[model samples]
Target: MNAAPSVRAVIARHCRELLADPLLHGDPTLRDIAAQCHQPLRVLLVGNVSTGKSTLLNALIAGPLAATAFEETTSSVTWYHGPEPADPVLPDPGHRSVTTDFPLAGRVMLGDSPGLNTLSDNPRETLRMLGGSDLTGAAAAFVCVLVGGRVDQWAEGLEELAAFSAGPFDLVGNIVAVMAKVDEVDEAVEDIERRVSGDTTATFRFAAVNQLMAAAARTGAVDDRIVATLDRLRTLPVMHGRSAPAWDRLAEEVGTALPPGHLKALEQVVGAPAWLPALVAATAGMTTTGAVAEQFERMSRIRSLEAVLSDLADDSDLFTSTAAVLRLRRLAARLKPRPAALVRARLADLTATMHTSGLHRRAAARLVRHTDVGSGLTEHERAAAQALLRWPDAGADGGGTSDRATAAEVDVGAVLARWTAYEADPFRDSRSREVAALVIETARHRLRTTTRQEES
Candidate 1:
């Protein structure tokens, strides 16, 4: 009766079958990579063009990560993830490097991508990038930030958000609207809050008081007004007044709005039972997974385009073929990832088919593309990709247990046991030290590896 457990059982069965194969067992790295590919959580930032998506990103990281301005910014999707910064922040896989120390929180990974409006020569490419990013995993939640502007400007964005929320990915509810740049608004913050609260269609639970106060505080401009605003935000009765709304609520709202097959992939990322309804709702209007596959294929094309652009930018000599240059710029302007709405809709369709037919291998196969195998991957990319393709069949039946499921079920008692052991003999077993060393080493290796690839 519990859809999550039922679906998970099916996934586990398939994984077991795959792991039993000798070819898969021979490569442990591939096995591990495949395991990680089974599910991943994605958090997407949704807003209108010129909204402070990038600014919020910078604020979250507490450093200048993505480019931001008062005008339309964020030309492409930028992803940020774990291992916390020890000294200075660095971009994953490729792009520019940073040198500021920032603390990290593991609750969620953040993605800042191009917004809906465009002055870019390649708007299609931008959309493609957004879609590609969506396929990477389930959108755990959406941060919908709105700047002070006519409410109508947000209509399209709200529609898009609503569509994304409709998909399976939002098993628990995934939309959180934020009224950003509140300081610039002429009305009192309370009035704005009241107005937002009154709006039933797209009312926000959380609002960011203009960071003007936070910014000023950093510079020692501590005023009573700033303190008051912060206090009000901290005490606001957003999202049913309970300390914090469960993550599932956010996941559900977004999942219900997205395209079908897209949301299932997203649902996998978010994890749990709440996703079933969202998945079912998402598939209500779709007939097949063709649309979902098309979006992923489109993303691959965009990636290829980005590769071409990077090559051309690095060396104009690379473009000996006239067709290549034209193709390069043509795709560049259309680089945004696919919309959550589209992905949600597609996912819903796929899930509906799966539920009816008792699991469709074709649909399962199609969902595989959403897995992220890391960027600028070398030998590992090919290996990771292969493992990802075979992951659905790599569980207990195949001779390996499901670490994810097991990890997900660790008892609180066991956690307490481990904590007690650590406290009793801090360095007796030194397992914690080993884990720390491994993490540090892995982070160092990742940084070096990316740097070398860029240099190459």
Candidate 2:
């Protein structure tokens, strides 16, 4: 027998069937939903005022789509659609949407939300978006920006937001807490990570990033012109200071190499002079724009953020499918009897199709991250399960030859035996047993695939 179809394929197939079905045909909302099934995963960026939400959004999409400044800039949620366009409106005027040529358009789209903890009513806008029940025009994942050393203060707020952002089933994969502008903080990223390591309520992964550095590197702000300015600054004796030189004194020293207009622009691009000496020292001999950008990118610590995004993107299908299913279920509730019945029928078929693969992946993620459920397993077992959960290209239709080659080496029988026994344990909690059964199905699929390959 053939392997089960991927969640996306199943959704797409059903979408076609729905459009052709007499009960659902000509429904604009259903058409919109059909189109969204094929679009990239929508990931929203949100945080407190001036926490670098816009800067991080620009960095992620490699464009200055959202306005950024010291004061509150973004007043509403703006969805940055990928190369292809989908529904722009979120059924609310507070939200705005635009399309761009971001290289990762097919894999992920991004949304920039107004900051929280502000004096103005901006916080309410963000809260309203998060509070909505309908997944229509909703983000599948979220990157919550927080300033360094403020994790403790915002821990409670973050937990509340996570409840709404992360889906009913997902725990860790759907949300990420990012400490933006970490360069300004005295403490290191590792220090912050260790600080929050014990916070059980914050289920998402943590990353500390210098949004300015990442934005500069990504937006090509660190070009040869900036390098020349840096080189000129290095020659001036006054530039080497324990504290940054005053703006007036530095302007005099700069003289003609950097005119007043150019100097101010440079200030905006590279940030304060306190970190320029470090940048000059880091890129000591680099001469080209690409070389400078490379050095700056390394200094940015942006790769850590990128790696997190890459892992999230690898599981895009899971998020997309989950969001789509939830969206359809909710849509069905309010529809008329005929269309509602058809939608319910289609949703059931979709669920039965993806039960083993898509649903099980979500269950495994939840089981691994749940403190109580995870603790029930041995350390070795937990680690193995996590490794398998994060294992790249575990989806049915997609992995490369290397992925299959690696899978061929796994002791599938041993994996099946262990998880199967865990599922059958009478002492296990009903919740744990249910999740374990899902995990066992995942293992069984792997065993079957491995067996077929070996037979071939």
Candidate 3:
């Protein structure tokens, strides 16, 4: 079988066909979407004051391109893309654009906005990028929301920002909540994940990251001087807390080996005195710079954050498609009766035929990613749902999709029944019911496909 056309290609084809219909030819909204659908997967990093949003952006790009400081340094919206601008002709003076070389530059566009809930005009600048501006629609396809020290306060701000950008579709799928500066807090990463996931007010997935260390690891901040200093410090006793005196003692013990000004620099690189001991322990026998950087990378937990971001990025096309369809619907609702009917019919046909099993499963997974959304689901029911969404073609035993195409005949009927009932329940929130509806469709399709395979 031939490969399916990309989501953008499909949308472009439909746009051509619909524009020929004369009714949607000059529609402003349709024209805007046609122009913007080609934009790269736009990911915006947003948070309250000093949540390490800039630091995280620097880490992601593997450079210190974004300015980082203890205070609010990012005053304006800075957009980073590869050498080529996603939309060069667009006139949006509110943002500062930076073109650079980065791994994901060609595939994704990264935006770093000013912190929200600040004393100055920072919040307004950020709000504009989040779709409060008069120029265009929402700037980002997905938002990486950062939460630091005070979770409740940051979450409150996030809730308000989420409300402002709210659309007909639930924005939960378009969000990824990041608990930044996890090392600064006393709570374990797992505990932090559980705590954030338990918050019913937020519906996005969660990740715990140490942005400083992650940047250090990615940017090669751990040099030979730092490694030698760590090696010298390792000769002495292990330090306990992050108190100033303990660090002073360690510096004094190393004496002439660690110079007066170098001690402060070492502290700056390693983040905290507590991390010195852990780094010494992590690189007990290591001597090379690469070895030390690898250890620091592992301790940074940046990989976990990258994985979460990668999952969202992989579904960029689907998210863009969904947004475009929603825009078309909203536009259709505003048109005259005859024009609106034509647009609606074309949209309905495109949506019904455009989505594939993989896209459908991904959409379903996003809906139920946080377990709270599927609270009423049984353990077995949830497992089956995971299997279907994650590895639909794999056997019940579990393996890569390429390894085998064993029919996942387990719990299909039960999953269909339960999710169908959940979708019909009026007491559930619209978002949960929407999730149930997607899962139900996926289950019904899977059951039919499995039966056909069995017969063959």
Most accurate candidate by lDDT: 2
Q: List candidate 1 segments past 4 Å from native.
A: 1-40, 84-104, 121-126, 129-138, 149-156, 169-172, 202-206, 212-456
lDDT comparing candidate 2 with the true structure? 0.68
RMSD of 1: 24.6
**C-alpha RMSD values across all candidates:** 24.6, 4.7, 5.3
Model 3 regions lying over 4 Å from their true place: 1-32, 82-107, 118-123, 134-137, 141-148, 160-171, 238-254, 325-362, 373-440, 446-456
> What does candidate 1's lDDT look like per residue over 110-224, in tens digits?
5676776676642343344233332222233456667772354664665565444333221112345566665445555557656664554442234544432222222223333
lDDT of each: 0.37, 0.68, 0.65
* Tens digits of lDDT, candidate 2, 1-456: 243455766676777788898877865556655555566777888888888999988887787777899998988888787656565534244567788766466567777888887889877777754655454435667888988556787778677766654454544567778888876676656787787766645667678887787788788787656777767777878766665675567788888877446666556666656566777677777778788877777776778877677666766666766666766777788788998998899887765653434545644654565445646567656555544543433544344223222333445566567767887778888867766666666667766766898999
How many steric overlaps are in each model, in order? 90, 0, 0
Model 3 residue 406 lDDT? 23
lDDT of 3 by residue, 321-340 (tens): 66666566666777799888
lDDT of 1: 0.37
Residue 233, candidate 2: C-alpha displacement in angstroms: 4.5
The model with the greatest TM-score is 2
